[model samples]
Target: MTTGMEELAARMRDFAQAREWEQFHTPKNLAMALAGEVGELIGEFQWLTPAESSSLDEETFDRVRSELADVTAYLVRLADLLGVDLIEATKAKLEENERRYDANLYRGSARKAPH
Candidate 1:
């Protein structure tokens, strides 16, 4: 069975409600929180080389995973407050990205396709 965005969103809602943090979860505030979480996630990789990044030890990996979950939670909360369907929006955005970045043309290339 797959756990979907709805369940995650519900949990986030309840968690925030329980803490009486709804007022602090405005889209702008959530976005900033999300950014901070992302920054924390990035900091985990700050001095790691590519190989080191790919080979994080268990303890560090767990920290990275938790930071990632925090980012997702804030992002979901922001989307929920803004009346956006995260699942549908993600699917649409993925489709758009696929169209904009053709694998045939972009294969083995790190450079983004010019608009």
Candidate 2:
């Protein structure tokens, strides 16, 4: 069954609270942790060529998956701690992006539109 953000956030909160990790779960610390996890996720592709990166072996894929989960967890934790609803924030950002990157103008283009 699929779990909602509230459930996930609650789980993270319980996990942190149980370990008395709230002291370390400040926005600044959580953001830093998220960044570090993202770095680790990127490191999984560090030596691979573009094609190789796209087709990872099982072991490599597993490592990347774990790192990705870490990144997501930390990001959710940070958003929760800051009282931000990530789902709403993401939807709002996508709406903003639609205005900035109109499909008709930006379609199939690699260049970013100047704000």
Clashing pairs counted in every model: 0, 0
Cα displacement (Å) at residue 75, model 2:
0.5
Worst 10-residue lDDT window, candidate 2: 106-115
For each candidate, give its TM-score against the true structure.
0.88, 0.90
lDDT for model 1: 0.90
lDDT values, one for every candidate:
0.90, 0.90
Clash count for candidate 2 is 0
| lDDT of candidate 1 over 1-115, digit per residue (tens) | 4457778888999999999999888888999999999999999999999999999999999999999999998888899889898888889999999998888988877666555
Model 2, position 22, has a per-residue lDDT of 92
In model 2, the Cα lDDT at residue 9 comes to 89
Q: CA shift at 17, candidate 1, in angstroms?
A: 1.8
- Backbone clash total for model 1 is 0
